[model samples]
Target: MAADSRAARPLQKMFSEVPATYDLINRLFTLRLDQAWRKIAAKECMRENPRLVLDLCTGTGDLALSMAGQARPGMHIAAVDFSLPMLLEGRLKFVAPGQRVGFVLGDVGKLPFREGSFDAIGIAFAFRNLVYKNRERDKYLSEILRVLSPGGKLVIVETSRPRSPLVRLLFHWYMRTAVSFLAGLISGRGAAYKYLAHSAINFYSSGDLSDLLESAGFRRVQYRTFLFGVCALHLAYREGPGNMENS
Candidate 1:
């Protein structure tokens, strides 16, 4: 998918405006649970002790940095984002750690790597943007599969629907009113938070995300929900061609 595409225009414009306060706004909006959630996702990404990891759509590289912090010796971490400003912010954040993770400015639809390049891949809070109402969703999934090694993990932390109706209603109300208001006020990026709020309110349930991943040929999908199920962490594996056929 091109950055200039219609579906991505608002996203591009929104992200371009929020890099300065993106991390901080996220902390406030999620009441700092976002960091803890990322830590859990990072742990799952390293569950197999992958030698190389890719953080896709690594906005400001928070999860990438978390992975870098706990990385074993010789564990290489890399991140990719299409937004130059966001990638620059990620680089600045990496300075304190002496540049442990490689940051690349590129599109997810056309990852700049060879087939089977990464031992594991992780995305935080951005999975919905990749699949929600996206016409080129299959293309992006194909690119992700192209770069992931067989049996490589794809760990994702994303907003999800609550199984409880009451919890879901309250979550949606808070998102629409408080989160959008404060996040937009602090970040001065109302459109971005509007998109964020809308997406979070409408994103897939855990089961739905798992089914989507499996339909794309990933295997053994599992998920854990948190905070009355408003957020979810998923783990899925890339099945090799032979294994995919057998399965």
Candidate 2:
């Protein structure tokens, strides 16, 4: 798909088009670091001790699965995405009934739920993928805020550029060259992998995103960088009625 077309199409369309190859491409492009990143995000997301969790943009339910494992054994998770094909593919992996895990087809930007509906919400490598054309993106962030319970937590896991000059230079070259080539060979979507690398470098820095979270009404936001700053895990909490904990 051309860059413009990929950018213009609805997220569901692109994801469904590539559903069969999504996981393979993801692993190859990330060099399997994606797994470790999700694990860290899951652990942090579980810190709030949520009873019901929401995994937005839950592609193939990888992050949701991790979150489920961290939550209490019977805890329920609402894993939602706009792409039904991707959801179906993900559903085949697990045998969770609605009591434990449930999958829904919905867009993250326009989540279907009520206020303070979930104890925690998680988005991993899915924020940037959202079709944010203009200020419309703010609505998506606000929706997240509205759906989160007071004192609930929001965890984000996404790639970031390394700060070290020499290391960043090498990482950039590898992503532009070797990573794209390997991803193309396996998934037949080298161009998508190319865009993936570009998206990582273009996405917000840990600090910038933390500010966005604050602007969205979250308090006591903090972030942790991993893989020498190649990835970031952001933690933000919805303010409760009482005094908020600084940590």
Candidate 3:
């Protein structure tokens, strides 16, 4: 609650405590733009023509679902998160049977997968919860790169602070007051909503995070800002394990 160095457990506990309403609150807070954002994110990842994908921190499986929907209709996706209840809720969201999505119980920092196993890795609106200053952030990036195949891609979608003063004023007001109020009304967890707002503010900007990705052994790193600079999508490629060493 105080923005400490070790806030992951607190936030994880909060998400687990409110797993039933997490999806509802997410939609309310983002004013339904979250779905569209996921669609765009999925499209961006699919550009690499990845057949196998992993959605890290795939809360409620929205991004994974979008990836499955937007991809070449036969893409295999592993949607993973530590919260089982959230995955359960996501499973029920799909009305039809035989979806191509598989939900796995795992942590993003240490994935239970083999090296070079996936063609693409994605995380949407979930990175800030891990806290950028944490060592786990490095672990997340390392695992991401390790699990991605040669020339694989990693796309991270996160919230950003508005650069325009007028937009910042409106964005802050919406985040602290409107978003929190709606989230509280739907999920009965205004405190969690407040924590989310704080996290967004403290989260790194697109440029800063791109540097982190580069430092983590990713190449061709770049970022795309969206939603009036209130959101960003970071794209980077894994040059295959050991390939960089020889070349």
Candidate 4:
């Protein structure tokens, strides 16, 4: 059996233990830039005026709450995560009046939704766990594609490998050292932060991500870099509704 087959359970357990300080550690590590990044992902989610949006792997619901603030009246948002504690933490911060937001506890590998359910999907920082070295990568990607309506879009904001060698080394060192130590210290979840540091240090580059998305059947993929390529936003499109060719 592939290691990733077992990755899900441990990852779920790791996340469940850190809900209390997850948001705070994020703010500290990124200097509160994560919220801004989520807002960007939220804008991409709403750019096409999607009727239904799904926040995939919505840890602490930050991305969903960001989307709720900008979501059109009557628009529906569904946020899902396997970790119950994370979902509960996110629920406490959700206060978007007149905006529809629903939190569901479930695994991303098997989303409980009909085919072509959401017009758009957004994920923040959780893309790596679903793709990087995950033996079930195809299954998870296919499930995402399955739930997206025709001509729908999938937006992603995630850590990226820096392009420059020197900067990359510096960033990796910081991630492995300061980020790992500080996050563990603050969250009291050393193993989780250790995994976080390891994952981010060795994740894919922007170009690699584009190819991955394209090969996964996204008709088109667009990328934007942030903080000198340390983070990236990916916009992936399904084929046009009704099998029409998108120009």
TM-score of each: 0.92, 0.86, 0.87, 0.93
Q: Give the alpha carbon lDDT tens digit for every residue of 172-223 in model 2.
A: 7877776666766676766666666676656676788788789878988998
The prediction achieving the highest lDDT against the true structure is 4
Index of the highest-TM-score prediction: 4
C-alpha lDDT score of every prediction, in listed order: 0.86, 0.75, 0.77, 0.88
> lDDT value for candidate 2?
0.75
Which has the higher lDDT value, candidate number 1 or candidate number 4? 4
Model 4 stretches with alpha carbons more than 4 Å out: 1-8, 242-247
Which 10 consecutive residues of model 2 have the lowest summed lDDT?
1-10
Q: Which ten residues in a row have the lowest lDDT in candidate 4?
A: 1-10
Query: What local lDDT does model 4 show for residue 42?
Result: 99
RMSD of 1: 3.4
* Candidates sorted by TM-score, best first: 4, 1, 3, 2
What TM-score number comes out for model 2? 0.86
| Model 4: how far residue 244 lies from native, Å | 11
For model 1, residues 65-177, the per-residue Cα lDDT tens digits are 98998889888999998887888888877777445888887788878889998888999999999999888799999999889888788889999999999999999999989
Provide the global lDDT of candidate 1 against the true structure. 0.86
Model 4 residue-pair collision total: 0
- For model 3, how many clashes? 0
